[model samples]
Target: MSVNSESVAKKIKELPHIFVILFCVIVLSAIATYIIPAGQYTRVMDEGIKRMVIDPTSFRYIPNTPVGPFAMFVAIELGLIEAANITFLIFAAFSCLYLMEKTGAVDASIALMVNKTKKNPKFSIGLIVVLMIILAVWGSTGTLSYEEIIAFAPIFVALSIALGYDAITGVAISVVPVGIGFASATVNPFTIGVAQTIAELPVFSGLGYRCAVLVVMTTFTIVYVMRYASMVKKDPSKSLVSGIDYSDFTIDDARMSTPFTFQRKLSMLTLFVGVCVMGYGLIFLKWYINQVAAIFMIVSVIVGIINRWSANRIANTLCEGLSKGVLAALIVGVARGILVVITQGNILDTIIHSCVGVLQHLSLHVSAIGMLVFQNLLNFLIPSGSGQAAVSMPIMTPIADLIHMNRQIAVLIFQFGDGFSNLLWPTSFMVIVCAMVRIPLSRYYRWIIPFYAICFLLQAAFILGAVAINYGPF
Candidate 1:
């Protein structure tokens, strides 16, 4: 093959679009039902929490209930139905953030921040660090979806560009910290909460250790991102997204020269306050998806009125935002669709049980590491952190007991496996961010691998330490 032809072939060999990947997984999961035996564990109420948990000693294989080819298509719709709440939450959150973006307040604020600190690279780095920590904390709540953050992509892209960095740096500024924070989840309701419940451990216990993990991961991500951002700013050609038509995400001269008006500041203030309030509601009010949706809607309306946007204009912007999220929402449903097939066919537990059984003979510390590996691999099939916890924790809890492993360590391993990979996995919410910013999935995978390696090492070390010290309350 000629050189040009070779380049073309290489391009063709790149990973398929996320939708295609998810669809193929859905089909394969449906087919696997026939091969993987159907089995379930009996559930019993935990005396302290009054939550039903799998009785570790009560698992038994049941008759296989394999899904047919036709049923595979049905699983897609069922997956959408199962994921409806999160889907709608994504739509609503995107719409609200879209409304704020349309007002140009957030963009203006980002531009202003960039301009004020552009002269001081360290100051600009500090800005990136602060934004990352905030986003990471929000992600740790386990309630913020990638869709909610998608609207901020353009703003950060513009900010990074203004700081003489590239679009990929902007994307990293927006997502990498959240991914790290997510991996080091302390009180994350989705992973920690669900896994603890299933494991019959006190919810959010063992957080001291998790906090330490979070600090290390967040600090490392900040350094990694700052180094890359500085390198790109020094030489734009070094940027991953160099030569891409990212002008759409860049702040033009006209936008930059424009003064940041008081109305814009207040509008930005409203956005911050809204997020703070939402965080409060999530942490204290015990809010879920619907509540998050409602809060975003309310905030959008308030910001709209503050921006003096007429009802008709606000309505149009909201619709446009919702449209932007359609791809992401569909992606969520399609990814969830694979889980639906595996779940409805009753093979999820079997898969977990079988994997855990393999770890039975390993040394306890190695078994804990094996559990982390299993959960990490399983996360590819089931990207939803809470869903994976629901499916795996029941079996893992018992395995922890059988192998003399601390249940809290098991939950910690689950948290690490379920979350750290979201940044790396193609079939995950990270794809939604990629879709929003037009970042190719493969490019993101390449950019994130080193950081992910560091995270994995940290997580393994933490898990091993947990095992050694018996990190637990149970």
Candidate 2:
């Protein structure tokens, strides 16, 4: 090829990696800090929730907060500190999961299942539904954060391949279900709980509607996944990843028929019981990242003892898992760094205020739609559901009251806005999953945009319905 052609070819062949994308975002956010005015809302303590909330009306310009070049680097450092919990959990949880894999218990279990149902497409569909339900419940309970879900991705991918499907199918059954449940969670404390309390409503009081949303969303996700899986199974050429080689990672009968030994059974049981305990702690004890990390540590030790593996073997497995998780951990910190830049610049609330300004003096229906769109846009900068709630709800709640719109509808709008878009945005968990599965972001974006559109329309209908019924406890 000629020099110009070679340059063009290289440019076409190289897609921007996650690091490149996040770095650009970081730089853009830094520039925004300089351009966007700094402002703050006075925060008052909400005694009921034990957290401070923004006094929406108290906005004032705070001079001299714009990020300088040096401060941008400092923001990245601070972002790592802010993201420490998630990063550590990803490393530790994946370490434990890797330790479990060393025992061959999970693999054996999957293999056994595959051997039993490899011939039956119906059985494969059933497994997909079951896995979706399990993930959905985990998300609904608010225990499964992005890092926690990473540990499950490889297992589901292996299972999907074993059952004659692609890695995308694996992701659909694993991460997608969790996202669906999160978007429509009936009892998720992080999103629903926080938003409701901020709205001055009883916590988890409007469950009848949330439960309905959950069922509908979960069912849609399952059917969508199965249809894709069915197509890929019938014609492997139809797979999105058909051109990509997955030979080394694919599972077959020989791997499956490997004996499910007594030690392996014990190890598997240890993992199962650990998860149950973790779930209980998450709901009843209000466990956070630290508690979940401790649970994984305990389970790793138990699995090692059950397998009679040497300390060195356990240590080596842990190191390997941590190594694999490093990219994801870095991504989380980088994403948080972008938020830090925006926050320190004081532009986050300014952006929120601007969005709210657009909806003011509009009809309640238009304002509700505007709020949903605003939340969706804000999520790109503040990806954390609870974090977004703390910042946005204080403002949104009173706006609802002013317009004579139900606060419950406001919370419901927040729920949908904070969620469904999570999968579409680059700054959210989509990058983590794309990294985990080795799918290029460009392809995943193209494939998922259609699905996002469908979900968004459904969400709009729900918001309008809530408005019509004045859905609320107040």
Candidate 3:
């Protein structure tokens, strides 16, 4: 073990922890603000989209708005402020989770699921596919944001391990479907909704084609995950985290026989009712995190009462859950800081403008592909779906028109670009979810590389097919 050999070996195995990785990207992004020239486009309000949209013809070179080194430090606080809704909801959701866990409801549910998986393994496999589809529906049609999956990640991971599979299998069933759904967004308000409205196409007008895409991608993802799960189950050594302890997740006959008591059932019902109320408000009242957070607070109190917990006991349990999630939630804010730096420097438009310059020279085929690749890269800088839409779509819409590409196809390209690398990118929810479930980003990346490669192939076919068929009525 000479010094050089040891260094080489260390390089082979060592990747920075997730926080260090995100912070390094942040510093680099802040530095980029000084290097990349700052520029701007006029943002006039559009009544239809109900937001300020870029005026493509109004692009102009502006004086640099570089964030100072001290300002870069300040942006972390600003980033948390900008991301307050998500950060607050993280606390609320975790509190509710802890409230449920204390009442024996959480273990009872897992115990029951394990019992069923033992009796009917094939049915359990089918259940994975079904679960992915359900999540995809929520992601595709509604405003399912990244960190929103926090409530379900642990449960699914525990369930997957209990079923003799691995942690990645749990993510495959839970997070991957949502990511794919976002990539193939059929009616997602954040991506399609904003993009379509900006393009002046009817909102959700191309539902039929998008739904077909959702089906194809969803099917492929299910097969990919199932194959992996089957392999890991048969040879436990193949599991990425095979050496990991899952003390809280594993169960035995005594645990399996844990009674489904009446109090536990009521606790579960109370939580379900809270979710139902949130859904109603989301669809009809157009609610977001603020509304969802309020509902969870109410639910936690009811859950405490239903289980006959003293007020102090309820408070303690709620705080316990909140403590478990601070790391995960702060990751979201730290990631948000990267976007804040980019925004503070006013370099976001400059980045988009520079890419558009390169794109303008390519042939129609290459231009379409370029847009997809560019969007994927840009997501590293701007992780907010609607925010990306607001910034990118106005520029892209005219690009579509100039090249005789359908606006719908342009929208699809943006959708694919914005979503496919979500979990792969350190700045996105992938880091948060991986942290929450105790999976290392490097290991998760190894597992996901193949999945992302196949996803790109699928994206290429769908984008090209849409071009061939002129995938639009408008």
Top lDDT model: 3
- Candidate 2 TM-score versus the reference: 0.95
Angstrom error at residue 229, model 1 = 1.9
Write candidate 1's Cα lDDT for 298-333 as tens digits: 888888888888999989999998987898888888
313: Cα error in model 2, Å: 2.1
- How do the residues 1-474 of candidate 2 rate in per-residue lDDT, one tens digit apiece? 899998897567546999898888899999998888887788898886788789989988788488888988888889889999888888888889888876778789888888778566478778778889988867876777565776778888888888889888888889888888888868889999999999989998788988888888888788777888889999999987776777655766567777899999888888889888888998899888888888898999889878888889888888988987888888889888999898888888788777777777889898988888888898898888988898889999989999999999999999999988998998887788788778777767756888888888889888998899989973
The residue ranges of model 1 lying beyond 4 angstroms of the native Cα positions read 1-10, 43-52, 141-147
The superposed Cα distance between candidate 2 and the true structure at residue 300, in angstroms, equals 0.7
Model 3 misplaced regions, further than 4 Å: 1-12, 252-254
What would the per-residue lDDT of candidate 3 be over residues 127-146, giving only the tens digit for each residue? 88888998887778665556
Lowest lDDT 10-residue stretch of candidate 2: 246-255
TM-score of each: 0.92, 0.95, 0.95
lDDT of predicted model 2:
0.84
